[model samples]
Each structure stands twice: as structure tokens, then as C-alpha cells.
Target chain A: MIWVNTIVQGILLGGLYALFAAGLSLVFGIMRLVNLAHGDLIVLGAYLILLLVTLLGLSPFVAVLVAAPAMFALGWALQRYMLNRVLGDDILPPLLVTFGLSIVLQNALLEGFSADSQRLPTAGLASASIELGAINVGVLPLMTLVTAVLVIVVLNQIFYRTRLGRAFRATSDDAVTASLMGIKPANIFAVATGIAMIIVTIAALYLGTRANFDPSVGPARLIYAFEAVIIGGLGSLWGTLLGGIIIGLAQTLGAAINPEWQILSGHIAFLLVLLVRPRGLFPRAVD
Target chain B: MTLINASSHRVEIATSASRLAAIAGFVIVVLLFAAPAFVSRRLLQDLFFILTMLGLAQCWNLLAGYGGLVSIGQQAFVGIGAYALFGTSILLGVNPVPAILIGGVVAALLAIPTAFFAFRLAGAYFAIGTWVIAEIVRLLVAQWKMLGGGTGTSLPNSIRREFWFTETIQDLFGVRAAASRDILAYWLALILVLSVIGGIYWLLRSRRGLALSAVRDNLQAARSVGVDALRMRWFVFISAAFGTGMIGALIYMQKARISPDAAFSVQDWTAYVIFIVVIGGIGTIEGPIIGVLVFFILQALLADFGSWYLMILGVIGIAVMLFAPRGLWGLFSDRTGIQLFPIRRRLVRPMISNDKREG
Candidate 1:
């Protein structure tokens, strides 16, 4: 029964991991850019929510509603103005630029908030749990799982069912061809990054409410997100969700054996996955 | 009448301008070696840090500049080397100096598996794969209780007193044991930096160096030309690991302490090195040297500002990447064409003598 409960909890934790990884997957699927600052941007979104929660006395969820658009705008501007110039055949420019951006964001956050950990006041939501047969689950984790699914569903809809989605796919396939078809690759990229930032804002809501975060925590989160994305395979959103579950299960089971092995177990699982399937479990045929 | 022309050949590695700079560089290195004689202990220690950082930046540049492997997880080698030093000396009671070499071998061995995993991923994924591997190594090391586990351990007094040069250094400098230890560490650091820089320059001048740049410029093009890109990459990766491992060991030895976090700190070891290399010039040999000086100057000027100092560094790094991607040295070299450590081969034939004379 305990093992069953642990597995169930791990599944819920996977939902949050998926949320952390969704935007990264989205951006990579389109531009082929692996944003080193993705995790830091998520942290920045969390800080935005924190600001609204404290200064305006808004609930974390409501704070996300306000912060999402702001982040979207910032993302669009960042892509159109700065990142676009560095995107091309050479990979180092984008990678190094994002790395520098990551450092800049983390240090700026630290300078603003100090190194002290901060969390959103969850109003008892964090500890609230319900009995499901033989196991108990936290409300926050369950909500996080639902949100992750809904976000993926909506993203899939946008990717496959809309004109903007066509532009995104067309540009991703061949930007020059897309341009010939009157699709501006730059604008498409800006929109894609903006959407990714919105998802980042959603992830931030759960992250801030569920856990304490300091400026330096970005890189660790980035590792988890990267592991999840790689495990699922690049360009596959559903695979990212599964990757998150696998990591979450490994971490939980390892913790069940010994607390010290929890993080190591997740990393080992990631390595094992890489060794077995270098291209990931569900690699996109295009890239 | 028959006329014969006599030919003269010059195989000079440097131009006259760079030849002058080389002389100056040699003089500076000699002065640095004699630093213990007149410099304060604190200045010596600071120089040790700078030299170590300079070596690390060079190794990273070799991998990224010529080899095209932009790794963000070099701390893996650093941590492994540091712990290997501790393990070899404390557990096996090996001599500390030789143990540092052993640490290099251990790190290189570990890097083999790391390359196997990371090489599977292309472009950006490869970068993150290295980081994940580094974190895994750090976590695994933290669990090893023999080396003080999570808390960390300091070098034993016995081992500290037993360094071969400690006695000699103390006798020669006529200083306290602590001061003498610092002097020895400083000299070791100086040697390490010189060898790392010289070795890199020599490698760049070799034929294999041209192959490395070919591979970096275009994998398929190089492969089509029978360059064997993978072999070159493997060579660069393994050599980088070896050098980085030795650097890590020497660094921990200087501090006389080994902790997982300190040894594997992405901020201290990787990020700063990346910043230095990028802001100096990525592919050029002189870039990291120029980068480190800029780094030290910034650090000296703003280190007191705490987080703000870091923010300033972050800001400068981003600004440089966005505006001056070639870095300060790259910009300067582009305009002046003066290379202190010139590697590119140039054919210089003093205006083929137009006048023919019979001797």
C-alpha cells in the first residue's frame, strides 16, 4: 500500500515536472534553440507572481493571470530584438547568449531579493490533501497535474488546429520557404516564445505556491526540465510528460530506498534512458 | 654567362611585432616566478588564483574554440580531480604531487563515459547532457563517506607537512611553514599555467590543429575531406579532461580543502571561465589571457558590492555577447593583427631577389 501511494505521489509530482518542461519543449520544437535561461525565465515569472501576491494581495492563481501577459510581452521583445540576431547555422551564439542571459537573470534576482528563499503564501493549499481510497494526495499536486494536462492539450490545439499553428510549423520546417509563403519567421518565433513565456508563467504559479525558491535554484530546475525533455524526445510534447513521470518515479522510489539516493536515482534513470535510446523514446523524425 | 641564385629560408613562428611581445611575456613570467622573493604572501595567493583560472580558461577554449564542444559542466572534471586527490593522498597515502597526476588520469577515465553519453546528443542537448552528468557526479561524490561525505574534509596535517618541496621552500625563502607552503603552491600554479598555455600553443601550431578547426567549421565538409572529425573531437575531449582534472587537483591542494559544492561549483569554475573566454575571444589563444585580466579588474573593482558585483558581471557578459561577440582581444586583434602567440603559418619570402649575381 505504501509503495502504491508512493507511485501515485510520483505521478502527481510528474505533472509539475511536465509544467516546468512544456515551454522548453515548445520553444525547441520550433526554433531548435535550447534556451539555457529557460529555467531562469521560469524563476523570473515566479518572482513576478510573488510581487503581485505581496504588493497587490492577490491569490497566486490570480497573480498568474496578471503576470502571464507581462511575461509574454517580455518574451516577444527578447526574441525579436536580441535573440533573433544570434539565430543561424552556428549554435554557439544562441547557447552562449542564453547562458549569459541566465547569469544576468539570476544575479539580478539575487540583487533584488537577496539570496534568501521566498515562497508564496498558499493559504493552506499546499498541505491540504484528500484521501483517495488507500492513499492520500495533496490538492496542490493534483491541481498541478490537471493544469499540466490542460496546458498540453491547449498547446496541441494551437500547434495543429490554427492558422498561427500552421505558421509555426511552416517556419520550423523551413523559414525561407515560410517567408516565401508570406509567413514572417521572426514574428512567428516571437509569438512562439511569447506563448512559451505564458506557459512559464503558469508553471511559476505552482512552483512558488508549492516550494521555496532562491535565485540559484534555476540551474537545478533546468537540469530536471532538460532531463524530462530529453527523455521524452525533442519535438514531442506528450513524450515530455512521460519523461517527467519516469524521473519522478525514479526519484520517489530512490527516496523510498534511501533519502540520499533520490536525486542520484533520477540522474541515473536519465543516463540509462540516454544510453538505451540516444535520440529519446519518441524522437521527432524531422530533427 | 650562367647565373645561380642562392636561397635563404626562415621558419620564424612570430612576426617582428609579436616577437617583441613574446620577449615581454617571457620577462613577465620570470618575474612572476621570482614573486615569492619580494611579494607579500597575500599577493602570491591572489596570483595563484589568477594563474589557475587562466589555465582553466585555456583548456575550455581548446575544447570550445577549436573542437566545437561548448560544455557547461566542466565542474565534473574539477570535482572528480579534487576528490581523487583527497582519496589518493588520504586513503592510499600516496605522495600529494604524484596524486595530482593520478587525479588527472581518473578524470580522463571518467570523461570517456561522459563523452560517450554527451556525444549522442547534438548541438544544444549536448551542453545540457554534460551539465546533468556533472550534477550526477557531484551527488554521487557527496554520498561517499570515506571523504567526509556531504560535510567535506581538509588535508591532514601530516600530509600537509609531508609535501616534498615544503622543506626546501621554507629553507630557501627563510619564511614560516605556512608562508612556505603558499610559495610552493604558487610556484606549482605558475608552472601549471605556463605548461597549459605552452602546450595549447604548440598543439595549435601542429597539423592536427588545422584539422581541429576544420572539424569545428563544418563536420560534414571536414569528413568529406577525409579529416576524421570524430577522432579529432575525441582527442580534444580527452586532453581537455586530463588538463582540467590536473587543474582541479592543484586548485584544491592550494586551498587544502575538498568539498563537493566548492569543488563542483558551476558559478566559480564553469560560469566565470565561460565569461572570461567569451569576453576575451572564443577561438583565439590570446583571448582567455585578455579575458582573465578583464575579469580580475572587474572583480577587484566591484567585488565589494556582493550580489551587485555578480549582476554587473552578468550584465557585462550579456552586453559583450550581444554587442561585441568577438570579445575585447578579438576586436583589438582584428584591427591590429598583432598576435602575441601566433599559430597560423605564414610564408614570408623577402621579395624574391630580382638581382642575380654569379659568385
Candidate 2:
């Protein structure tokens, strides 16, 4: 019974990992850019949400509504003015640029927030848990998992159902041909990054509410998010979710065995998965 | 026998500027080597920092700039190398000098498994995969109780007594054991910088260097032309790890302390190295040499500003990537065409060439 409870808790935790990775996956799917700053951007989003909640006295949930659009604009501008300039034949520029951005974001956060850890005040929602037969689950983790699913579902709808989705697909397939067909790859990339940032905002809401965060935590989250992306395989959204679950399960199970092994277990699980499926469990693109 | 006579045509690999620069570089290195005699211990420590960082930057430039590996997790080698030195010295009672070499071997061995996993991903994903490996190594190393686990441990006082040159330097220099130790470390760092620079320059001028740049520019093209891409990548990756590990061990040995956090710090080992390479210029031997000096000066000037200094460096790195993608040395080279270490071969037609007579 206790083991079952741990498994359930692990699956719930996977939801948060998936949330952290969804934005990264989407950006990469469209632009083939692995933003080294994605984790820092998420941290930036959390701080933004924290700011709005504190300054406006709004509920944490409502603060995201205000922060999301702002984050979208920031992402859109970032892609248009910076990332697009460096996105050609050589892979070094974009990688280095994003890496520099990551350092800038992390240090800026430290300058602004200091080295102190901060958390979103969640009223009693953080401590609230519900029972399911022999197992119990935290409300925050449950909500996080549900929100992750919803975000993926909505992102899928935008990718397949909307005209914008067609533009995104066309541009991703071949930028020159897509541009010849009246689709602007730069604008599409900017829009895609904007949408990714909105997802980041949603992920930030949960991240801030569930745990304490400091400037230095972003890089660790980046490693986890990156692991989830790789385990899920490149360009596969659903695979990312499963990847997250695998990592989360590894961490929880490892912790169950020994507290010190929690993070190490997740990394080992990632390596194991790589050994078995080098292309990820659900590879979407042939490339 | 041939349409173009051998004596009439020459392949030139060095320019007048490069020849002059080579002589100047020798003089600079000689001065640096003798600095401990005239300089204060404080100055020696600072020079040690610059030399060690220059060595690491040179290694990274070889991997990323020449080989196109673009790894962001080089701290794995650095941390593992440091830990190996500490572990062997503390546990096996090995002398710290030889232990530094063992650290290099361990780091090179670790690279085999790391490459196995990281090579599965292409380009940007490869960068992230390496970072994951580094994190895994850091977490595991933290569990070693003999190394003081998470809190970390310092080298024993006996290490100072046991260090190869400490007493020799103490007697010769008439300084304290600690100052003599610093002087010895500074000399090691100077030697490391010279060897790393010389080794890289030699490699870049060799046949393998040509293959490396070819691989960097286009993997498929290089393979199509009969270049063994996998072998090249593996060779460069392992060599880089070995050099980086040795430097890591040397650094920690100088500090005389080892914590998983300090040993494995991504910011100190990887980020700073990356920044140095980017701002210096990725593909050239001269870039890192220039970049390290600039970095040292900037660091010294901004040491008091804390995070703001890092922010400024980050911004500078981004700006360089955007506007002058080849880095400061690249920009200067483009304008002046003055290569201090020329690798590009120019074909020169002699005044008595058959071509002139034929035309």
C-alpha cells in the first residue's frame, strides 16, 4: 500500500517535470533551438508572478493571468530581435547566445531577488491533500499534472487545428519553401516562442507555489527538463510526459531506497533509457 | 617531369607577422616563468589563476571551436579530476603530484561513457545531455563519505610536506612552506598554459587539425571525403577531458580544499571557460590567448560588483556572438589580416616559375 502511494505520488510529480519541458519541446519542435535559458525563463516567470501577486494583492492563480501576456511579449521580442539573428547554418551562435542569456537572467535575478529563496503564498492549498482508497495525493501536485495535460492538449490544438499551426508546420518543414509559400519563418518563430513562454508562465505558477526557489535552482531544473525532453524523444509531446514520469518515478523510488540517491537515481534512469532507446521512446521526427 | 616545377612553387604556412609573434611569445613565456622570483605571492596567485584558466579555455576551444562538440558540461571532467586527485591522495596515500596525472586518466576514462550517451543527441541537444551527465557525476561524488560527503574535505597538512617541490622551493626561495607551495603551483600553471597553447597550436597545424576543422564545418561532407568522423570526435573529446582533468586537479590542489559544489561548479569551470572562448574567438589559437587577458582584466576590475560583473560579461558575450561572431581576435584579424599563428596555407609562385614562362 505504501509502495502504491509512492508510485502515485511519483506520477503526480511527473506532471511538474512535463510542464517544465513542454515549452522547451515546443520551441525545439519548431525552431530546433534548445534554449539553454528555458529554465531561467521559467524562473523569471515565477518571479514575475510573485511580483504581481505581492504588488497587486491578487491571488497567485490570478497573478498568472496578468503575467502570461507580458511573458509572451518578452518571449516574442527575444526571438525576433535576438534569437532570429543567430539562427542559421552554424549551431554555435544560437547555443552561445542562449547560454549567455541564461547567465544574464540568472545573475539579474540574483541581483534583483538576492540569494534568498522565495515562494508563492498558496493560502492552505499547498498543504491540502485528498485520499484515494489506500493512497493519498497532494492537491497541488494533482492540479499541476492536470494543468500539464491541459496545456499539451491546447498546444496540440493550436498546432493541428488552427491556421497558425499550418504556418508553424510549414516553416518548420522548410523555411525557404515556407517563405516562398507566403509564410514568414521569423514571425512564426516569434509566435511559437511567445506561446512557449505562456506555457512557461503556467509552469512557473505551479513551481513557485509548490516549492521554494532561488536564482541558482534554475540550472538544476534545466537539467531535469532537458532529461525529460531527451527521454521523451525529440519532437514528441506525449513522449515528454512519459519521460517526466520515468524520471519522477526514479527519483521517488531512489529516495525510498536512500535519501541521498534521489537526484542520482533520476539521472541514472535517464542514462538507462538512453541506453535502451537512443532516439527516445517516441521519436516524432526522423531527424 | 611535372608541369609545375617543385622549386618554382612553395606552400607557405607562416607569415612574417606570425614569425615575429612566435619570437615575442617565447619571450613572454620566459618572463612569465621567471615571475615568481620577482613578484609577490599575491601576484603569483593571480598569475596562477590566469594561467590555469587559459589552459582550460584552450582545451575547450579545441573541443568546441575546432571539433564542434560545443559541450556545456565540461565541469564533469573538472570535478571528477579534482575528486580523483583528492581521493587518491587521501585514501591511497599517493603523492598529490602524480595524483593530478591520475585525475586526468580518470577524467579521460569518464569521457568514454559520457560520449556514448551524449553522441546520441545532435548539436544543441548534445550540449544539454553533457550537462545532465555532469550533474549525475556531481550528485554521486557528493555521496562519497570518505571525501566528507556533501560538506567536502581539505587536503591534509602532510600534503604540503609531501609535495615534491615545496621544500626545494622553501629552501631555494627562502620563503614559508605555504608561499613556496604557491610558487610551485604557479610554475605548474605556467607550464600547463605553455604546453596547452603549444600543443593546440601544433595540433592545429597538423593533418588531424585539418580533419578537425573539416569535421566542424560539415560532418557529412567530411565523412564523404573519407574522414573518420567518429574517431575524430572521440579522440578530441578524450584528449580534452584529459587536459581539463589535469587542470582541474592542479586548481584544487592549489586551493588545498575540495567540495563537490566547488569542485563541480558549472559557473566557475564551464561558464567562464565558455565565455572566454566566445569572447576571444572560437576557432583560432590567438583568440583564447587574447580572451584570457581581457577576461582577467575585466574580472579584476569588476570583482567588487558581484553578480553585476557576471551580467556584464554575459551581455558582452551575447553582443560579440551577435555582431562579431568570430570574437575580438576574429574581428581584428579580419581588418588587419595579421595572423600571429597562421594555419592557412598560401601557395606562392616563385619569380622563376614555369607558369610565367608558359604564359
Candidate 3:
């Protein structure tokens, strides 16, 4: 019964990991960019939401509504002015630039927010749990999983069901040919990044509410997201969810045996998955 | 002008600037070596920092700038190497000096498995994969309770007192044990920097160097031309790990303390090194030397500002990548084709013209 409970909790935790990775997957799928600053940007969104909640006395839920659009604009401007300029044949510039951005964002957040950990002011929702058969699950965690599924569903709709989705697919397939057909790869990239940032804002809401976060934790978050993306396959959204669950399960099971091995177990599980399926369990793109 | 043989074309690797640099380099190295004799211990320590960083930057340059391996998890090697040094010295009762070598070996051995996993991913994914491996290593090292587990441990006082060359330096310089250790560490750093720089230069000027750069530029093209791209990657990867591990061990040995956090710090070990390489120039021998000096100056000036200093460094690094993609040295070299350590081979045509006969 306890083991079953742990497994349930693990699957719930996987929802947050999947949320962390969904934005990363979207950006990578369209642009083939592994934003080193993706995790930092998520933290930045959390900080933004935290600011709105504190300054205006709005609920964390409402604060995200306000922060999401602002984050989208920031992402659009970032991609347009910075990332697009460095995206070409050579991979070094984009990688280094984002790496620098990661450091800069982390430091800026530290300078502004101090080194102390901060959490979203969750009123009772954080502690509220409901009985589900044999296991009790936190309301926030359950909500997080639902939100992740919804985000993926909406993103998939935008990716496949819209005219803009056609442009995205065309540009991703061949930028030159897409350009010949009057699609602006640059604008598409910017919009994609902006949408990714909105997803980041959503992830931030759960991240801030669920646990305490400091500036330094961004990199660890990045590793977790990266592992999920890799384990799920390069461009597969559903694979990312499964990847997140595997990692979450590994962590919980490892912690059950020995608390110190929690994080290590997740990394080892990632390596083991890679050993068995180097292309990930559900690779979408051939690359 | 005298007539020369028409078929006397020869390949040239040396330029006037490089020849001049060679002489200047000798003088500078000799001065650096003699500095401990008269220089204050404080200055020696600073120099030590610059030299070790320069060494690490060069190792990274070889991996990323030349081999196109763009690893962001180099701290893996550094941390593992440092821990290996600590584990051997403390547990196996080995001397710290030779223990440093063992650290390099261990780190290189570890790279085989790291590469096995990381190579599965391409380009940007490879960078993240390597970082995951580094994190894994850090967590595992932290679990070694014998090494003080998470809190970390310090080298024994006896180890420091009996460290190689420390007694010799203490007697010769008539300095305190601490100052003698500083001097010895500084000398080791000096030697490491020299060898790293010299070895990289030598490798760059060799046939294999051509292949390595070929692999970096276009892997498929290089393979088409019969260059063993995979072999080159493995060779560069393992060599870099070995050098980085040695530097890591040496650094911790000098500090005489080891914590998994400090040893595996990406900001200190990897981020700073990456910035130095990016700011100096990525693909040239002159880049890291120039970069290390610039980085030292910047750190000296802005280090008091704490996180702000890092923000500034980050901003500068981004600006450099965007505006001066080749780095400060690359920008300068572009304006004036002066290569102080020239690696590009040129075909020097015969002085006498036989154009009519050839035509």
C-alpha cells in the first residue's frame, strides 16, 4: 500500500517535470535551439509572478495571468533582438550567448531578490489533499498535472491545427523554401519563443507554489528539463511526459531506499534509458 | 635579385611575428619563473590563479574551439579529479603530488563512459548531456562519507608540510612553510601553463591538428576526406579530461581543502573558463593568453561587486560573441594579419618566375 502511494506521488511529481520541459520541447522542435537560459527564464517568470502577487495582493493564479503576456513580449523581444542574430551555421555563438544569458539572469535575480529562497503564497491549496482510492494527492500537484496536459494539448492544437502552425512546420522543414513561399522564419521563430515563454510562465506558477526556489536552483532545473526532453525523444511532446515520469519515479524510488540517492537515481535512470534507447523512447524527428 | 629554382616552393609555418613572439615568450616565462624569488607571496598567488585559469581555458579551447565538442560540463572532470586526489591521498596514503597524476588518470578513464553517453546526443543536446553527467558525479562524490560526505574535508597538516618541493622551497627561499607551499604551487602552475600552451601549439602545428580542425569544421566532409572524425573526437575529449582533471587536483591541493560543491562549481571552473575562451578568441593560440589577462584585469576590478561582477562578465561575454565573434584577439588579428603563434601553413612560391615555361 505504501509502495503504491509512492508510485502515485511519483506520477504526480512527473507532471511538474513535464511542465518544466514542455516549453523547452516546443522551442527546440521549431528552432533546434537548446536554450541554456530556459530554466533561468522560468525562474524569471516565477519572480515576475511573485512580484505581481506581492505588490498587488492578487492570487498567484491571477498573478500568472498578468505575468504571462509580459513574459511573451519579453521572449519575443529576446528572440528577435538577440537569439535570431546568432542562429546560423555555427552553433558556438548561440550556445555561448544563451550560456551568458543564464549567468546574467541568475546574477540579476540574486542581486535583486537576494540569495534567499522564496515561495509563492499558496493559501491552503498547497496543504490541501484529497483521497484518491488508496493514495492521497496534493491538490496543487493534481492541478499541475492537469495543467501540463492542457498546455500540451493547446500547444499541439496551435502546432497542427492553425495556419500559423503550417508556417511553423514549413519554416522548420526548410527555412529557405519557407522563405520563398513568403514565410518569415525570423518572425515565426520569435512567435514560437514567445509562446514558449507563456508556457514557462505556467510552469513557474506551479514551481513557485510547490517548493522554495533560489537563484542557484535554475541550473538543476535545467538539467531535469533536459533529461526529460532527451528521455522523451527530441521532438516528441508525449515522450517528454513519459520521460518526466520515469525520472520522477526513479527519484521517489531512490529516496525510498536512501534519501541521499534521490537526485542521483534520476540521473542514473536517464543514463540507463539512454543506454537502452539512445534516440529516446518516442523520438518524433529523425534528427 | 638572384634567380632561384622554379620548383623550390616550400611550406612555411613560421611568420615574422611568431618568430618575434617566440623570443618575447621566452623572456616572459623566465621572468615569471624568477618572480617567486623576489615577488611578494600575494602577487605569486594571483599569478598562480591566472596561470591555472589560462591552462584550463587552453584545454577548453582545444576541445571546443578546435574539436567542436562545446562541452558545458567540464566541471565533471575537475570535480572527479579533485576527489580522486583527495580519496587517494587520504585513503590510500599516497603523496599528493603523484595523487594529482592519478586524478588525471581517473578523470580520463571516466571520460570514456561520459563520451559513450554524451556522444549519443548531437550539438546542443551533447552540451546538456555532459552537464547531467557532471551533476551525477558531484552527487556521487558527495556520498563518500570518508571524504567528509557533503560537508567536505581538508588535507592533513602533515600532507601539506611534507608536500613535494615544499621543503626544498622552504630551505632555499628561507620562507615559511605556507609561503614555500605557495611558491611551489605557483611554479607548478607556471609549468602547467607552459606545457599546456606549448603542447597545444605543437599539436596545432601537426598533421593531426589539421585533421582535428577539419573534424571541427565539417565532420562529414572530414570523414569523406579520410579523417577519422570519431577517433579525433575521442582523442580530444580524453586529452581535455586529463588536463582538466590534473588542474582540478592541483587547484584543490593548493587550497588544501575539498568540498564537492566547491570542486564541482560550474561558475568557477567551467563558466569562467568558457568566458575566457570566448573573450580571448576561440580558435587561435594567442586568444587564451590575451583572454586570461583581460579576464584577470576585469575580475580584479569588479570582483568586489559580487553577483554584479558576474552579470557584467556575462554581458561582456554576450556582447563579444555577438559583435566580435572571434573574440578580442580575433578582431585585432583580422585587422592586422599578425599571428603571434602562427598555425596556418602557407606555400611560399619560388622567388624566380618560370611563368612562361609553366604556361
Per-residue lDDT over B258-293 for candidate 3, one digit per residue giving the tens place of the 0 to 100 score: 999999999999999999999999998889988999
DockQ of candidates 1 onward, in order?
0.79, 0.91, 0.94
Clashing pairs in 1: none
Better of 1 and 2 by DockQ: 2
* Residue B45 lDDT in candidate 1: 85
lDDT of 2 by residue, B214-293 (tens): 99999999999999999999999999999999999999999989899989889999999999999999888889988999
Q: TM-score for candidate 2, please give it.
A: 0.98
Candidate 1 lDDT tens digits, A18-72? 9999999999999998999999999999999999999999999899999999999
What CAPRI-style quality would you assign to candidate 1? Answer: medium
TM-score, every prediction: 0.97, 0.98, 0.98
Segments of candidate 2 deviating more than 4 angstroms: B1-7, B353-359
Of 1 and 2, the candidate ranking higher by lDDT = 2
Per-residue accuracy of model 1 over B273-293 as CA lDDT, tens digit each:
999999899898889999998
Between 1 and 2, whose TM-score is larger?
2
**Recovered native contacts, candidate 2:** 0.92
